[model samples]
Target: MAPTTERASIFDPDALERVRRELRLHPQQLRVVRNAYFKTFASEQETLALFPAPERVHLDPLPLHQRLDSTLDGASKLLFRTSSGLLTEAVVLRPRSGRSSLCVSSQVGCAAACRFCATGTMGIARGLSVPEVLGQVVAAGQLLAREQRRLRNVVFMGMGEPFHNEANVSEAVARLIDPSYFNLSPGKVMVSSVGVTDGMLRFGERFPRVGLALSLHSVRPDVREQLIPLAKRYPLDELRKTVRELNVMQGRPVMLEYLMLAGLTDTDEDLRALLAWTDGLDVHVNLIPYNPIDAAPELVGSSPEVCRVFAAALKEHGRKTTVRRSLGRDIEAACGQLVKAHTLSERRAPRSDTSSA
Candidate 1:
């Protein structure tokens, strides 16, 4: 026989207020001029009425990890695990004062297998559910509120290949952008892909206004393939074509992410290739220094001189480029490094006695 399921209540004042603020609800609608308690109750009901689909309903942030921890009598920590084979576990990082952003996964372990990436070495796991994907954001919000923070953005550059899980990613974006729920402007969100053409095209068609970023580490096909295995299937030429189409469809510039690696993809030749590839396109280059990973001990970040030269070359080609200074590196929160420590620790852990006995 199938297990019985309980219907869960969706009312949450904090989640409702955060949703209201994010959606920019009118003051008159939020005003409580009548019976204070009744007015508050009516406001919440009206908010619920705004979203007919339960999935579209934005509730107070309740992360699965926190709920699990509390319910299990502090027996275990519920880490945010992705369906994407790229990562074994994750923690939803909630910012303290800015708009809320969900750090979403695209793969379990990345098949791109970039030497400098800890997640890349882990191999692909599977894509997360549309609900699970959005759940990370909800969890972040709930945790952030406890720390007096809110979620405002969503990044697909967490642990997986968003393009590999295009369908679910699209669905999550649709639900997030729905006016009845989170109602976030398309411009505020970004979908980062490691140069997946089909997924990029599909995303453009489905949500033309949502922001897009290509995890283009190098313009040279060989270098790209070495860093991102997807490059083998969708080479630079094809990727550029898809990017151009996306720009034309959105009528705005797309973000191009360039991860600078020392003695690897930061050479003058590489800069020239990058410029040539992006020639006459509506796009912005975000130059990111490679985050060191123990998995690939030889991989090192580009020197300041090399990074500056690369950025200068892009500018000389009449392209807009900016250096993305590393944030959260002190806390091991930099790109591609988040999953490394956890993965290493897990591999070293002894097998549970229950399994052996």
Candidate 2:
């Protein structure tokens, strides 16, 4: 009896028939041939680069808003959309000097739920995708360049939890750092997290050269948790430990973001806790006054006197600190304010129609 001959299928049916005919394979051998050909073709496809050809569909060269208008027919002005699905909806604030920066969203709505933050009230929706995350930078870059400006920096203090969305956020960072794409230096980017230890650790490993900011509103555990619910899950002690590890790993000082709320979490005790937690660590404290929101009327911005006292205490402890002046206040560009207004306006519209009818 003759031994069975192994046959393989060529991926192209016509090619397979030609080869089979040329080889004059037996009927059984043809079945074996077909299978082998498909297996090899599938393997080759897997290794091939899948990104769309750069020339076929170019991202419009026009500015961000213009592209947006062209895409959406100028209906929706780029305001804060819910941060969960899109991660964050942002307005590309056209810079006065043509120098712009992106206010990127870390999470959809913040889980922090800080007393003064509208985003917090909305709660965490979802994390943004890598492309969605990078899209914000691309949008800002287009808008800025239209006005003869360029993006100088990127702030990840927008609507979402950056640390929570670490994977996508890191991917987006990788894209930004790519020269063919945004080509942004790691130094020009800043990521703010509400002190999630696991996320922080991973972020440090993924982006060792990027800037990190801890949203350290109140160093006291109880007060901190009250201001940010996530604080309950990750206490100050744990957070401090994480920050120390991150600092050592990155070999750079981390930024401490302290939001001063009037009469709340701004006492001498708060200052002492902050100093203690940050003691012997390389860090810079950025004091940001509470951006007022209607959702929490009780929360108010800290006065200059209170901010000064805290700054002095931090200085006394030999910790570096700087006060952040509020920008875009008039345009509702302050953190959470734009989203809050959008939410309020949306709610009022239905009520107004009902009353009119």
Candidate 3:
């Protein structure tokens, strides 16, 4: 819990307004502070310099604890620490296309327990607050601003199942696209889910322009259940129906995220099932290469040739498909690999007590 005298989060406009009223500063002064902080993504010091009473405002509620840059690609993993010492991760992806993107987490850990996901192995600690979620964008945006590049996209594809934290995630999205806040285009924001049917419907209805991706790794009921334990609760048929509804609600093709596991989800039978399942649905298929993780030793990614062949087969069937370029493999920031190893190690370390006498 925050202390009584804790500074107000810059993400909370109400709190900032209250602070402004208390300080008796001109309204334009607060607007300048907001423009510098949210729009320009200025450094905390620089943003605070614009305000008369900097001591009363807190720029970042979640302080960045560590950052790891990938040696093989334009990807950087940022580890942030909450006030309670819990850790969450966000990834900055600078693909060759030059449209930089940020993947932010909604929870410290994940409860989905997907067999192949490292974060899923760690039971969820807690859902992030709205401020915590938006702070990631602020931090990442400032980092990109330093490099003279703006963050073009934000995806809820980092460490946790987004629908599980729907309320906070939804509130964060509201502020992200709100004209007076982050002011990003709704089309550039996406929330990926593991088939939370009700939440998906609600989210689609609320933010019709925002992209929604379903983690439909497998259409086979048994196989899907094995890969994603949450599948058992929301059956494949139900998920397909929800996707159809989302298509109509959003008036856009829903993204179906398919993970390619060699000999598991890449076989001829699996492809046929996928084709049959998506026969008439207006959806785009994204083929994601499986990133190897120690927790799931049996799951290996399909070969490049196999992925190409799979994509070719999809295109031949009139299905829109694109093989996603997996980034940050060397830094363990790729898909299914965002478990905070440092946080786990810290948890295992013995602590010493030095109480003042």
Candidate 4:
């Protein structure tokens, strides 16, 4: 547990207000500090310099446990240590377009237990507090700002099923788009889930402008259940309706995320079922190439050619589709992969450093 008198997170306005009153500082001073750190992503000293008695007003921060940059691509993975000693991750994707994006985790480990995900294998842990989630954006944004690049997008697609940790993730996202904080457009942030129906619907209603991505790895009920064990509870039929409802609520195409696993999810029937399920909903189908994880060696990614054919089929059926390019292949690019390997090696390095990757 944290100290009894824990500092307010830099993102927590209420806590900051209390701190300001206690310090007997002007309201504008608080604003300046917020704008400096949250908006500008300034260094610790630079931000603290703008405040009076900076040491007294504690801005809860997450430690940078480690940094992993992929040699093959513009991808960087950041591992942060929670006060609890458990590690969580955030990944930064820098495309050539110069608009960089950050992928933040909502939980330390995942409860959904998707068979293909490494985080799931670890079972459920505590949901990340708003600070932990937003710290990733602040830190990643600072990293990008130094490179003279803009942090254009933030996606909750890192370590866990987002909807499983809905409350904290929701608060973190609100501050991200709030002008007083990160000041990002709601459109630039995305929340991806493995079909947590109630939480998914609640998110759509709360943040209509923010994009939602459903990890529909398979449309077939049996296959989905096998791949995402949570499917057994939520079921595929309910998920389809939820997507349609999300469309009506948001007035935008919900993003359908499909991971292409060779024989498991990339077959003629799978394509047909997907087309059938999304026949009327407003959704952009994103076919993703699988990243191999040691936890699930049985799950082989579909070939590039097979993925292309799948995309072509979706387009032929008049569905909006894009084959998401795999970024950060060299540095255990999959979420939780680096941390899992590092944790095992700590007990079992020869550290598996990604700089040389």
Candidate 5:
């Protein structure tokens, strides 16, 4: 008899087959477990019961480190600890109109180094495995299910830029849309990137129907580079060209994400530059309010009055616009804010405090 191979993640390609061969279970048993665990978010016992080799399987690739719910909004942020002890975040936004969305993270920390974002300050952390990314979805879906709600949308606007971890993000989206797994509609899933031209173009060519958003926080090349250092590599002209190509590839308007900041990107010249950049492209503008991070004290959020004016200016220019309402502000709703705080707190904690809960 040959020695058996050690099992891998249940999300892995041959994980189920190996388990079926080892446990001598019927194919239907494995399918049931996958569907129950991945699709239906069944309980641990219920999912395990569907497998003869339950003990041999790796059910979860991510462990729930902490769960935080916003006292001010219907937003819940989940911090998941990877096997390496590093943490990533996912946010569940339950809006008033009832269509809930999950924001998933793609990396531990970000390499983008956007001046305003907390995660970017942490520097280049490791990319998350596909299982780790998908794990956030599973955990969030289960949490929503318990509240008698369903997750309707998935957005890669959590921690690291989606295009930064292009391969893993692509694979995760594929699994999300696959009927055998999350079964999310392509239109309901949105991938946001900080203007990685090549990655954005490739994604458009592949998942044509899956929505894409360009975080075009500033249209001026210098300001954009100052805010998002990756912008220097991408530049404005090349990025706008890529966006045009994506528009043609998808046969739909792409999302243009503009952060409304007081002095950084919300000025008259900035608005004109944005409109000029968006000219002749099929795009929708999403005006995001600046969520001030202590890491970027130089940045200040635009007032509501200013945001309204900016939206009006874009709409005046015949562009479709939406001002996204801020949620979970009291809970530091900005991506990577809570995780940064928690990571710093843990690092500061005395090693002598070894009492395990």
Candidate 6:
């Protein structure tokens, strides 16, 4: 009895090329398969049919375990079961603007421990591989294709802190925008970080056209440290400097994600501090309405009126700002509301004897 060999991911260039050589297939056949799976979001059976040796290549590295669609909005949360049996999540957002987006995770769980994020509650499991990260986009794209929509944007705002898994995430981004692969425009991909200065700089240098967003929920050092434990290592000044550098490198505005937490981040002082910090720096401030997470009971989102006023004040100061529309709240797929329930649900289930793949 011989041990079974694992299948190679279809997205892996080296593996796919090796398979192509071994099968003596033409390069065009491989190109067709790749384009079908990536560009057209074709089904696995459909994609594999285009190739002579179906078993030689595998389409999905992380299989879809379950999918939850929002009854309230056009948000679908796809829960993928990793080889270790841990469930990671990706969200497909179909905004009314007609440009669909998929939010992918970099790690199974977050290590940053942001108090306002549900993913931060479950301790870090491990960083997801390049295939695991890209698989999320593939699965979501296929789903959206079924509905006659093409995914236009890929956002790293799901379960994990992307910068913590910078190496794998950057490689995944490289494949995502490669013309031979997903073929997404560099501007369509955005990586959000909790102010990891070094990773942000490296990412900007590598993918100069790709967007970089800083999760600067608060400029106050004490408040930021309280919200994100990682903030202690990278102080507010360092983060501000990093954003300025990224703006220069990318030749575009760095997105500033400011979570509107009631009494915490929505105060007038917070707005003033944000204005001063962002002064002379090219940035587009995206004011996020915090979705309530059970892990952090003390935090609450700012009211709509307050959010409106905050956006107005930023506009008055000649700053670009927008209040991000809250989506997927019903299915727990909104901002800061992913992966916590999945961990809790898995814990309550009975233990199984099945071994991890």
Note the Cα lDDT for every prediction shown: 0.63, 0.63, 0.88, 0.86, 0.86, 0.86
Q: Identify the superior model by lDDT, candidate 1 or candidate 4.
A: 4
Instruction: Specify the highest-lDDT model's number.
Output: 3
For every model shown, the clashing-pair count is 27, 14, 0, 0, 0, 0
lDDT-superior candidate, 2 or 6: 6
Predicted candidate 4 versus true structure: per-residue lDDT over 102-217, tens digit per residue: 98999888888888888888754679888889888888988888888889999988988887778899999999999988899999999998889899999999999999999999
Model 3 quality (TM-score): 0.94
For model 6, residues 1-357, the per-residue Cα lDDT tens digits are 333343567867788777777667899999999999999999889999998878878886578777788998878888888777788888889998999999888888788888888778786558988889998998888888998999999999887888888899999999899999999999999999998899999999999999999999999899999999999999988888888888889999999999999999999999899999999999999999988887788999999999999999999999999999888888888643545665676789864443231
lDDT per residue as tens, model 5, 98-209: 9999999999889988898999887547789898999999888888878899889999998898887899999999999998888889999999999989999999999999
RMSD per prediction, one decimal? 9.2, 12.5, 4.0, 3.6, 2.2, 3.2
Candidate 5 similarity to native, TM-score: 0.94
Instruction: List ranges where model 6 is wrong by over 4 Å.
Output: 1-7, 335-338, 351-357
lDDT of 3 by residue, 218-274 (tens): 999999999999999999999989999998999999999999999999999999999
Write out the backbone clash pairs for model 3.
none
Per-model TM-score on C-alpha atoms: 0.73, 0.72, 0.94, 0.93, 0.94, 0.94
Q: What would the per-residue lDDT of candidate 2 be over residues 245-308, giving only the tens digit for each residue?
A: 9989999999999999876678877777777778888899999976678777777888988998
What tens-digit string does per-residue lDDT give for candidate 1 at 1-357? 332232222333445444445555653343331111121222333445544333434433223322222221211122454433223333344333445455666555666675557777765456777656765655454455555554567677777778778788887788667654456678877898888788888888888899999988888888788777767888788988998999888888889999889867888788778878888889999999877777777778898888898898788878999997554455455544545555555558852221110
Distance from true location, Cα of 67 in model 3, Å = 0.9
Candidates, ranked, lDDT: 3, 6, 5, 4, 1, 2
Error of 1 at 154 (Å): 1.2
